[model samples]
Each structure stands twice: as C-alpha cells, then as structure tokens.
Target: MARPEPEGRVRRFSTAERMVHRATGYLMLLCLASAACLYFGPLAQLVGRRHLMVTVHEWSGISLPLPSLLGLFSPAFRADLRRLNRFAVYDRQWLRAVRRRRKSPEARPAGKFNAGQKLYAGWIAGAVLVMMFTGLLMWFMGLLPFISRTSAIFVHDVLAWATTFVVLGHMRKALEDPEARLGMRTGYVNRSWAQRYHSRWLREEHVGDLSERRTVE
Candidate 1:
C-alpha cells in the first residue's frame, strides 16, 4: 500500500503510475497535434511540414500503448490495474450517485477510482486500441484493399473527434477537483480529500486514514 508523505495525506498514485500518466499525456498531445497538421489542409499549409507531421502522428500512435505495457513491470502499477478491473457494489452505486454528487448515500463508500473514472479508463483503453488498429490499416494502405484503407481512414477520423471530446470533458472535471491532480503529481492527497472524494477507498486501504472530508477550506 502506498502511503502519504508524512503530511497526513494518502497516497493515491504510485511513481510508476504517474510516469505512465505523464507519458500518455505527452503522447496523446503529440498524436492530436500531428494528426491535426496532417488531416487539415489549412494547418498543413500553415506549418508547411506535412512530411514530418505524418511521421510524428504515425509514430506517436504506434507508441500509445508503450507506457501502459511498460508500467506493468512495476508491482504498484499491476496492483492498480487489478483495482481498476474490479468493480464492486459501491461502484454501480457511485455511477448512479454522480448527478446527486455527495447528497446520495451511494456516494459514501466509493473506492479508489469511482465509476466514472473506471469507465473513462475502460473507454480510453478501447479508444486507443481502435486508433491503433485503424492507424495501422491506414499506414499500410497498399497492403489492403482500397475500400479497406478508406474505411480505416473514416473510422480513424471519427474516433479522433470522439477522443478529443472525451479528453476535454475529463479536463473540465479535473479542473473542478484540484486535489485529484495533486494526488497524481505528488503521489499523495490530503486525507480529507480522500474522505470526501473516495471515503471507501481510504477506509478500506489505509488503517486509521479515513478522515472524512466535508468541505474544502
């Protein structure tokens, strides 16, 4: 179990997990930017570097799963993976309680990752796989039928837009919860933050660490 750094905080992300997150962030941004440059004529002309943009997007897409696969080498990373895979009774309740925020009793015993977070993780994992498959098909256009290549490009473009929307929504929610960011960055979150946002997780994982958070000061 990862613990706080002596400030009464609780460890939320391991160093390995943070590294994977940072790598994913950078790679996703690179993929998005380079794809924009390659797909948009105006942007391609603005940058005047279509040659390099294609290479950047291709390699970035190819590397999207590297960080996650590499992070499996860490025990903490593997443990977090298991936790994300496990959806308890509280998880379903947490999903229903989203609109109610903390007003619902179901929100009281949420584990480390709420239902939303689990869904997001699952979603992005599937999205990445889709992107990678379509990207490979598009890249090796000559190896496949012309219609196949066309289909891949169409799916890839649509998923690009979908992923953009999902990421933006995630960013908006993260902005509303700065302590969640702190947990990722510092590997710890104030105990009170855990209590409010993830009471059951704190209580179940840490001994004497469940400090209920009512409001932020």
Candidate 2:
C-alpha cells in the first residue's frame, strides 16, 4: 500500500541566510583557487597574472568574514548559531558512532549539524580570523616591524593550509550526503529528511505548536 505523503510546511532557510551562505561560498572558492595557483605551479608565471591573482585572493579573503557578520543581524541565523554551537554531552557519543558506522549504521542519529559540522564551523571561524590578521600585516608590511611581517607570513601560510584541508573535508562530506546538498539547494528538506537529520533543530525551531507536530510526521 502507498503511504500518504507527509503534510506540513517545511521550514525554509531565510533569504538572508541563503544570501550570506552563497556569498561566502563564492568568495571562498575564489580565494582558494587563486591561492592554489599562487602556491604551486607555473600558472603563477603568466606575466602579471600572479600579482592579479594575489590581489583577488587577498580581497576575497577580506570579504569572507562579512557574510557571518551580516548573518548575525538575522534573528534566524543568530538563533540557529546559538543552537548549533552549543556543545552537547551527546556529541561525543555521536562522534563515536560515526567512527563505528561500518559496524552499526543505525546507532548514529543524524543531526541539524553533526559533531563534525560543529567542529568545522569553529575551526573555520578561528582560521579566518587568524588569516585576516596575518593578511592585514602582510598587506601593510612596512607599517610593522620586519619581525611582525615575517611572523605574520608564517602564520598566514600555516592557516591557509589548515583551511584548505578543512574545506576539502567539507566538500567530501557534502558529496557523500545528497540530502544535505538538496537542503541547501532548495532551501527546504522533506519532513523525513528533517526528522532524520535535523530533528533537534526542527524541534527547537517549532516548539509547542501545531507546526512542530506536522513537521515530525
């Protein structure tokens, strides 16, 4: 027998949230691509292209943090962040389950942002801040002492490598989870999808209302 399709309005991300996410995504790609070329390959030797790429990379890096700041002004994003960033006792258990996924797939319950996702968010935030400060020092090299410039460059390179690895992992996870991609693409997930992956967020967002019940079933 065919089951009835779930009924309820699927909560969508706000336009502000989507916009900021998209902007940051584009800028991060730009920065990473340019940085990659500059860091390795003969591509950097193409006349003035290296310098131009560096300029674009630097500006894009500078723009990366704007989205999160703008997103903070959004009540929804702010609220989501509050929930997503809270470290839970269960998160370690979730992490353990993920590590043992081959043995017990059903043991791990998906979440709005899993333990891995939360860790990524915090890492990226810290990395960007460090990169911004170091980039600034590099940009205004002569204003600071030689020691500062040298140290900043060292830190900048280190953090850039760290970000590169983190972004690669993020991309890999997104590829592995098609529903996660769809959620971002459509700005909505099916009720089952939400219940399976983001139940806590769904509950928190729609507590004590007819909407919450509708969303669960």
- Candidate maximizing TM-score: 1
Q: What lDDT does the true structure give each of the candidates? A: 0.83, 0.77
Backbone clash pairs for candidate 2 read: none
Q: Candidate 1: lDDT over CA atoms? A: 0.83
Question: What are the per-residue Cα lDDT tens digits for candidate 2 across 1-217?
Answer: 3233336536547667778778988988899889887887766765347778889989999999999898999997897687668878657767888777732424544456767888988898889888988898889877667557778889999889889888998999899988777667766667766776667666765664566568678
What TM-scores do the predictions have?
A: 0.87, 0.84
Model 2, residue 189: distance off in Å is 0.5
Q: Estimate, for each residue in 17-109, the C-alpha lDDT of model 1 and write its tens digit.
A: 999999998999999999889778898999977888889999999999999999999998998888888989888777667656766544556
lDDT at 216 for candidate 2? Answer: 75
The 10-residue segment with the lowest total lDDT in model 1: 208-217
Tell me how many clashing residue pairs each candidate has: 0, 0
Clashes of 1: 0
